[model samples]
Target chain A: MIKNKTGRIFEIIFYPLVSILIFLIIWDVGVKNSELSVVMPGPWEVVSKFIQSFAVPIGKYTMVYHILYSLMRVVPAYIVGSLAGIILGILMGWYPVINRILRPLYELIRPIPPIAWIPISIVWFGIGEGSKWFLIFLAAFVPITLNAYAGATTVDETLIKCSKMLGASDGQVFKTVVLPYSVPHIFTGLQVGLSTSWATVVAAEMIRSTEGVGWIIISSMDTNNVVQSLVGIMGIGVVGFILAIVMRKIEEVLCRWNRIET
Target chain B: MEQDRNLDIILKCENVSKKFQTKHRTKEVIGNINLEVRKNEFVVLFGPGQCGKTTMLNILSGLEKTTTGKVFLNDREVVEPGPDRGVVFQSISLYPWLTVMGNVEYGPKVRGINKKVRKEKAEYYIELVGLKGFENSYPNQISGGMKQRVGIARAYCNEPDVLFMDEPFSALDAQTRYLMQEEIMRIWEKEKRTVIFVTNNIEEALYLADRIILFTNCPTQIKKEYVIDLPRPRDYTSDDFLKLREEITENMAHTL
Candidate 1:
């Protein structure tokens, strides 16, 4: 059993490493042989440059600062948007009157993509951190609200009845049963919301930012530096992967009971 | 005897009838029926599968409303669900997010009982239902029979005036079903709360019930009543038990 577990772990690490090496080798050879090499640098050059950017500044700040600035915008907006969505969505799902009142207005806002609001957000909040935060907020808010609503509405009927039978008042039932049941669902919304907001941060920063992964790509485009553009994309990919893993770990902790051990 | 019966009656229903109205038709689920349950009596409502037995139990427990008629518990009309009446659902609806102790203590917890008091009450019932070591286990972590045990403990811990068990063991395997039957009997003997158990299983009805009320198919009404005087822990293979089972099965078959 011990040997098998070790073997499985080795297989997990070995296969992914092999796949990434193979991908990099193919890209390097392909770019060396192609006419596209003039515009696109080799994978080795892009990767080493991305690594070196951590210690050496790309423009005014290092890659670390670029990543931090992007995170600064995404984190606060995502947290606020998620909190608002969970509250509003759960209320809409639970109470018919709340749903009726908010649904029409929500539907109108939901269809407009966060990127579409870029021009108006710039007009309202100006070319500042406010406009960037607004765009990321919309991205996170939309998916989280829908998911939280789904969670609240889909609670088991028998469980609700059981709670009532157990002498729980209407409010008690909502707090104890409805809220706890919706948690797994809320986490699902959070996962989607987090990714959506992180993705939107690039567009949000496009409004006007000095140090961000988005600015690196936008600045690279002006200088026609393909290597820097690749570095920025790589930064986005690594951070997004880390964020998803962190969200999943938190969900596993909070929703331990939801996991059925077969 | 008649005066004592009237005085002992803890739950009574009068002219109970229910009809569900949809767009196309109004379907009668329960026809006119009346029942009187004496305190500490184990009354089983036995019928064919998919009959209105569960519906009857729901109406009596005040989980659902009757189209016409009234249900009285301790001389008070039961219009809505309350702590005085507990229900053990067929689905074994333990709060999935809550642990065994949490589910059991939920009744008192919601009713404003202190954490210490409710916890103590919950522990006693948990031990009573043979789930002492499983207090921390979630519903998904437990087996079906264990989940049902949690359901029973949850209802019992509430200290309701009566408990309505709607096909609680109908989902178990044959061996588990028999084991649960004996466990339920032992639990009932110790606690002796007024119980209204519903089941389509005839042998189970004979085994558990002091008084068995047989119900007909949908639009269900009382077809017959059996007063089983068998001794405690009656043997399933005993001549008396088999004889009673056969008699009841034949009588119930006629209702179809």
Candidate 2:
């Protein structure tokens, strides 16, 4: 097992590095021959810009500032929206009356894209962080709710019967059986929600915020600093990748008993 | 066999019937079935597929409600499922999220037993089932026969008045099933709870049961009852065992 794990780790590290090296060689050769460097900066230019931005620290306006600002808006909204969505979804799926009363409303609102609510959000809460937060909330909410509902509804009936036979009350059964069983699906939803939140954050920040990774890209685009814009874009991808890795680690720790299929 | 008849009745089913209504039709599954399980008795209900043996066992365990008649546990009418009747299903029904010890302790915890007491009870049963060192092992980490052992230990830990087994060893491989049968017999000998075992295996019924109740096909009714007079550690190759097996098989064939 140890030997296999070591071989796996070696493959994981070497495979990605080899791919990146090949891609960089192709990119550098292409940039030397064409005029595409003005529009799409090569990897070296983006890395240089990123390092220069890091070297300079201003008043809440560095690369770190934009990253933190984007995170602040996305994190709270993601938490609130996903948590509420999960709880409501479980209720809607578990009880007939709740499903009857809430399902139609959800179906109606879900079809309207989160971006479509931008105008209403601006009017209702103005062009401040509130509108951006609402957008992030909407982006995160729908998938979490749908996945949670599906997870709760599809719990194995035999497990519920077993729980009841063991003297678990209705609430206890829901807590122990329904909730835990739905976790893998719920985590799937959360991963989707997290990525969506990051995707939508750029749009939200561009629409309203004075500072964020999205704003940095827009400002760099306005000034025709394409390399800085590319830096901003790559930063977003890196942050998203980190978040995904963190979530996966958490899932592993919490669901140690669940056998993951390769 | 004599001791079983002499002991007080722990469970009684009086004219129990179960019917199910589907979208298109209503059908009776069991009809006017009556049974009594004396304390420490191992009674086997034997029949073929769709014989309502499972339905009857479910009704007795309060998992399925009887359309008519009643089930009594220690003279108290059973209306809902409770820990008083522990059930082992054909499938290994151990909670996937819980470890072997956790699965065993689930019943006691739900019944509001203290943590220490529940842990002790769970540990005792885990050891009883010869899974002493695998306390923290999850259900998925174990083999099929081991998982079934965990299920058996979990049910036994509750110390139920009557243990209801619904073809518990049917899913096991032939060799594992035979080994499990011996394990069950050993456990029964030691613990001596009233057990109502349901199976389609006639040889199994003959081997384990003090009394065997044979049922007819769908909308099942008890066709005959046989008192197994075989002694402990019954040899399957013995003349008396084979004779009983042949008689039961013939009876079942004739009913079919």
Candidate 3:
């Protein structure tokens, strides 16, 4: 079993590299040979241009500064929205009164996509970072709240009964039993919320921003630089993939007890 | 002996009945039922499947309310669940988030017990349940029977007035179930808490009960009571034991 796992870990690196190599080769050859190369540069030109953009300014700053800018907006907003959503969701799930009062308002707002809110957010917060933050915050809030509510509400009835039988009070049951039981569900929310936040970074940045991967895409559109736009998209894809891996790693660590041991 | 009889009753279920009303008819789960458990006695509530035995245990343990009547522990009414009555459920409700030590120490920790004291207390019960080396192991890492042991230890750590087991061994394999039966018996012998065990398994009831209370089906109530008077470490195949088993089985009414 140990040897097989070690072999698989090595294959993890080997398999991904092979697939990417195949994809890049296809893209590089197809674009170089095809008529579309006039409008869409070959993968080699885009990739090299992407490398150069790190040192030379794409607009006013390097590629690193753009990424940093986007991350700054996403991180704070994601954290705040996630925490608030988890708290509110748990409260609503646990308390019938709160659920009764807030559910209608939540259900009404939940369906109107976060992107649809861009116009209203821009109106309320202005075209500043506040608008960007609000958009990302909204994106993070919906999924996290839904997942947290499910987690808190669906806590095993028997476990709660067991806790009460063990002499836990109402608050004690919530803290000891409900909270722990809902953890896996909460993490599911966090994972979905994070990807949502990442997905919204472009929309948030497109509102108005001087730096960020989103700006890279939007500005490249003004200059009609399709290659730079694609590079921006590439950065987003790679970072998003890494972010998902990180989230999964954290969940595996925190919720080791939930996993079935082989 | 009379003095022992007068104050020995640790728990009493007085005229308890539970009825649930849906939109239409009212389904009665427990029909008027009464019981008394003396201190350190192992009393088994034996019944068929889905016979509201679990509901009865829940009411007795204060996990649920009786539609009518009350339960008393040391003469105090049990209106809600409290730490004084610990339950080991059939499903083995161990907190999957906590380690064996964490689960065992949970009751005391919640009740504001100091870390050192609760740890020592928890360790004792963990050892008592024969899980000494698995203090940090999570519930999922263990087998079904081991999870039940953790449940037992968690309940026992609180030092409750009575221990309620709602078909606690039903989930285990036949081999593991027998081993756990012996383990529980040994633990009870050493510690001697009032244990109210619920089970559909006649063999389990006969093996574990000091007195077996046979229960009827839905709208459930006690049908008959037998004081085992059998010697401990009971032989399942013993002539007297088999005779009593036959008597209980023959007299038992199976409806549907």
Candidate 4:
């Protein structure tokens, strides 16, 4: 049994590493043999240059500074938007009158993509940090609210009945039963919202920003620096991957009871 | 003596009936049901599967509204669900997020009982139901029988005037069902709360009930009542126990 457990663990790590190795090899071979090499550098060149940019400044600041700048915009806006959305969503879901009042307006606003708001947001908040924050907020707000609302609305009827039988009033039931029940659904929304916010931050940075991963890609086009653009793409990819893993870990901790261990 | 017996009644429901009117048709679920339960009496409502026994329990416990009737608890009319009456559901609806202690203490906590008092009450009931060391375990972490034990503890912690258990052990396997039957009997004997247990199993009814009210299929009403006078911890294979079981089963077969 111990041997089988070790074998399973080994298979998990070893196969993924092998798949990555194969992917890099295929990219290298494809680049060396084709005209695509002229425009797109090999994986080795891109990776080395990406690493070197951490030490050497690409334009005004290093690669790490670019990532830090992007994070500064995404994190605060995402937090505020998520908090507001959760409150509104749960309220809308729980109270039919609130839902009836706000639902039509919310539905109208929900479908218009965050990027579509760029022109108006720039007009409303200007080409400053305010505009960028506004865009990311919209991106985070939509999914989180929808999920939290769904969570509240879909709470098991039997659970509510049980709580009432146990002597919970309306407010107490909302706090104890409705809120905890909505947590897993809210977490799902947070995951989707985080990815959307990260994606939106890049797009938001594209509008008159100096140092960010998005700025790196947009600015590289003028100089025709393919390596720099690729480095920026790698930065976004690596950071986004790390963020998703961190979010999942937080969810696992908060929702420990939801899982069946066996 | 009649006045004393009337005063002894913990719960009484009069002329209770229920009807469900959906878009398609009006279906009658429960025909008239009248019952008076004395203090600490173990009354089992026995019937065939899906025979509106659960609905009848719901009405008596104030979880559902009756089409025509009134339910009185301690001479007070029951209009809605409150902590004064507790129900142990067949589904074993323990809050998945809460620990066993949390689920047990939830009733008192919401009713504004202090933390120390509620915790003490919860702990006492938890130990009574044999879930002492598992105070911190969530519902998902426990076995099915263990979860039902938590359900019972949660109900008992509320100190309701009467406890209604709706097919509480029917979900368990045969061995666990028997074990839970014994556990329930032991708990009832110790606590001596007025209990109205609903089940379809004759052996279970025979084992636990002081009296069994047999119910007919939907448009359900009381078909018969058996006064189970068998001694405590009665044997399933004993001649008297088997004889009573056969007679009840035969009576129930006619209703179908």
lDDT on C-alpha atoms for all candidate structures: 0.92, 0.87, 0.89, 0.92
Could you tell me the lDDT of residue A72 within candidate 3? 94
> Tens-digit lDDT track for model 3 on A104-211?
999998998888999999999999999999989988998999999999899999988887777778999999888888889999999999999998999988898889
What digit string (tens of lDDT, one per residue) describes model 1 on residues B84-174?
9999999999898889998999999999999999999999999999988999999998899999999999999999999999999989999
True contacts kept of each: 0.86, 0.61, 0.84, 0.77
List candidate 1 stretches off by more than 4 Å: A1-19, A33-36, B1-7
DockQ, every prediction: 0.80, 0.57, 0.75, 0.74
The better-scoring model by DockQ among 1 and 2 is 1
TM-score of each: 0.96, 0.95, 0.95, 0.95
User: Interface RMSD for every prediction, one decimal?
Assistant: 1.0, 2.3, 1.3, 1.1
lDDT of 2 by residue, A1-262 (tens): 2358779988979998899889878998898779986667777877777777666642247778878899998999999889988997888889979999999999998888788888898998899989999999988898899889988999988788888888899999998899988888888889999999988898888775678888878777678877778878877887898899998888888788896331
Q: Candidate 2: which pairs clash?
A: none
Q: Where does candidate 3 stray beyond 4 Å?
A: A1-8, A32-34, A260-262, B1-7, B254-256
Task: Rank by lDDT, highest first.
Answer: 4, 1, 3, 2
Docking tier of model 3: it is medium
Using TM-score as the yardstick, the better of models 3 and 4 is 3
- Model 4 misplacement above 4 A: A1-18, B1-7
Clashing pairs in 3: A167-B83
Deviation from native of the Cα of residue B189 in model 1, angstroms: 0.8
Ranking by DockQ: 1, 3, 4, 2
Residue lDDT tens for model 4, A126-178: 99999999999999999999999999999988889999999999999999999
Q: Give lDDT tens digits, candidate 4, residues B7-96.
A: 387899899999999999999999888988898888999998889999998998898999998999999999899999999999999999
